[model samples]
Target: MATSPAAPRAASGGPVRLSAAPADVAALIMHEADLLDERALEAWLALFTRDALYWVPADHGDSDPLRRISLFYDDRSIMEDRVWRLGHPKMFSQNPPARQVRVLSAPMVEASGADTMSVRTKFVMFEHRLREQRTFGGVYLHELVRQQQEWMIRRKVVHLVNRDTVLWNIGVPI
Candidate 1:
């Protein structure tokens, strides 16, 4: 969608120098995390673009979500399905449900254009379910697009620092 003059501009907003702490973009990112932690999947999905991707690579620094084994490589349709399953009473993995606490730091702007920006941030996620807790630490790289006058995530790639290790089947969305 064409950006309206009233739209909240990102780092590339004219002569202003981009800072790591781009307030507007950072707020969206944090809000996304909060939605997930609250298990508000439907609300969380609204933060993405229609063709968005939620990817978790099997190996650190891997970009090929399709070619490699991944915890998740969901597109829009898949995301919706996952969200449905998460709320389904019959979904076994969620027997006890999962609780999560995620901390995201100021994102480093990797690339920025008029309608797109790539930002990377460090994340430490604590997920607990079924009497067990797992701490997942990694870098979250997000590619956001300007759509309908908002910054929507086009692609969110998560590279777990311990991706090389076995996951034991994490029952929760990271």
Candidate 2:
């Protein structure tokens, strides 16, 4: 990828510095959601570090993407291809692509460091197409890094409340 190299992951065992005011981190997340709702996949992709992950687990509280089934477990390349395919004119599921709207709550700082922060937020998204509208709710956990005064997502783990339910062609991102 032509994006900036991935910033090193903050050691999980390190002393985490939680921020009292994580508004900036929260704003970046909302902006990304806006980009997705606008179907600006490429621009949305740019908000991530080169080695970022976009994951959605199948089990209610699953943490291991490698050990179990998942709704999505996309690395940079897979994410890129997914965005490309979603925008392709020949994609039937998106023939008349659903319109998506996301409402994200204020972010709660979960963990932080000098260069990394994890924010958790609740989201309710509605995908509308034709005469149908499907509602999706979840918790969005983002691990973001500070690079040159910019906050970029290193990992986005979404735990959907309806993870086990049968969903339609989730052609659009949550």
By TM-score, who's the top model here? Answer: 2
Question: RMSD, model 2, all Cα superposed?
Answer: 6.6
How far in Å is the alpha carbon of 145 misplaced in model 1?
A: 0.7
Q: Model 1, 1-174: lDDT tens per residue?
A: 111112235577754333584788999889988998999999998898889988887765455656778888889999989899889999877877888999998876767888899877789999888789888888777899988778999988877887777688665568
- Deviation of model 1 at 42, angstroms: 0.3
Cα-based TM-score, every candidate? 0.85, 0.87
lDDT by residue for model 2 (6-91), tens: 22234885544444436688789899999989999999999999999988877875767899888889999999899999988899
lDDT for 74 in candidate 1 is 89
Best by lDDT: 2
Q: List the residue pairs that clash in candidate 2.
A: none
